[model samples]
Target: MTTTGATKKVLVLFSGGQDSTTCLALALDRYDEVETIGFDYKQRHAVELGQREILRQALTRDFPAWRGRLGFDHLVRIEALAEMSQSAMTHDIEITLNEQGLPNTFVPGRNLLFLTFAAALAYRRGLTYIVAGMCETDYSGYPDCRDDAIKAMQIALNLGMEARFVMETPLMRLDKAATWRLAETLGGQKLVELIVEATHTCYLGDRRVRHDWGYGCGACPACELRAKGWREFKASPSA
Candidate 1:
């Protein structure tokens, strides 16, 4: 919590993606002084930029209470990562929509790197809360997105920074379907659907199919997972 007695100054690790967009909404609802942090991180394309900008505009335009809490940043370039091999994101390799599951689109150390940056930013701001959108149930099986990985990262951040930093993963236990439901409750069904339309999550870089759940190549693991979740969510009562 902050010393201002306004609860804590929470920083969200936002990416302008579907999950992160929802997390941003959740943070605004739960925190008194919520500040979102979206990074460039040298993604597959400018999709991150597009999504971040849309969310930034949407938050200030739609949510009057959170008008000034939206913050964004860009990383001009990333070094020493090109030779690290392709993961469908930075390469031409076929993104697995495979039946065996687990896709190669999993970028190495992605969550860990993002969380580390988020922790550093929160620590500098004297805040203890960092929000992230990670779910084990409906994901590409990125091992770092799990609860155990987050717990371990929390410990490391505490030890490294000498400050008790709490990484908040509200979507950790919920599947993609449940995520949509939460977004609807936090904001509204229409607003959540707006998020899906604006955010980006295409590993194959397909910006054509703009659904109410983010962009999709309609074939990769990410698109498949998101599409399937939405189908199930639309059918479920809680949706």
Candidate 2:
């Protein structure tokens, strides 16, 4: 969707990961004003939380065009969400699929709650769009990340808040490799390098060893997907 005039503003659901970082870049490119919001749910990879500020600083420092458009960064603490889940992401446990076939890393109602809170923040901030990094093409099988779920959330938020808020998920259909290509398309190799060096996606929160894709334990689902995508992206003819 095209946005113009004062309404060309967005609030990104940024989590300092590759997907959210790419989405942030896209929002800055497409919108006149852009704000970001992150959550601290006391996850295992809380290190990702720390990377948010560093990534924001790098974006404004390296990309001059996005500097003025980038606005406030809001962080919310909802520890109760983690307390309600005993999943691997919320606790120190194995990242395995449960009997229902969904991975234990799936924190139930995460995206739902995130969007609800984000819509509320956007309402107060006078933002028109809510951009997120949720993807279903190459994900851990989280139901909330699906397109239909996002659409439903948009309707619910708009109806509940009595405001017209558009939800944009740029990575909804793109896989990990395509997501990397999107980063390059948005900000060239500089953005890709920034993502590799700065963004954190490992579920285990291990950053000691640095790989081409970034720091991770290399065994968790997150790292594996990132590694595979990086390799595929590098192998692509255009890359």
Candidate 3:
């Protein structure tokens, strides 16, 4: 069957972060029905889990156009990932580059397992598309977030589940600045404000110190990238 929004519903891997919120908005704009799925992997940034509900409420109140198209939201708790991972994301250890040259924040198989669980959920929910915000651009070198990895996961999910589910990565090629631009394009400044105010991206889960981009610790890699992106986004003529 042809993959089109008119005929297909979507399940978004929403973590209540800027990138995922943008992907959710894209899914809402493109699909007839849009559902959201979030993982409670017991990461250090657990604050984002609560922001999911806040974002949902804000979306319902601010963006009436998408409120009706929004479907059930699913929060899956996978503690096993935390149990197996000693990464900075899963623990309170310092965030730094490892001997392999990759950041210690890299939780192995995170995106892979996320796609697997999302595909399984989609199979049960009759969703044909799985939208995620896994971006290689403006990110801390996560191998699982690469386009090739996502495509391979799509193939593996289809073959393993005997189902055809399209994996949509709207921000796959866009940097963080471009991501912000896309959010403005989709819902204008309202969406951008919603993301900046409501979404959470700080790995340390710090919400006290608010930056122009959003609430983050400002020292971790996540906050640094977000801050840099927000500055660039604002400086751009299109923004």
lDDT per residue (tens digit) for residues 92-196 in model 2: 988899989998999999999999999999999898899999999999899999999999999999999999999999999999999999999989999999999
lDDT of 3: 0.91
Candidate 1: segments with Cα more than 4 A from true spot? 1-6, 71-79, 97-101, 211-214
Superposed by TM-score, candidate 2 places the C-alpha of residue 156 at a distance from the truth, in angstroms, of 0.7
Q: Is candidate 1 or candidate 3 better by lDDT?
A: 3
Better of 2 and 3 by TM-score: 2
Q: Relative to the unseen true structure, what is the C-alpha lDDT of residue 199 in candidate 1, on a scale of 0 to 100?
A: 78
**Which prediction has the highest TM-score against the true structure?**
2
Model 3: CA > 4 A from native: 1-6
Per-residue accuracy of model 1 over 58-164 as CA lDDT, tens digit each:
87788787676655443323433434746666767765643446566677777787788788778777778988888887787888889999999999999998998
Every candidate's lDDT = 0.74, 0.94, 0.91
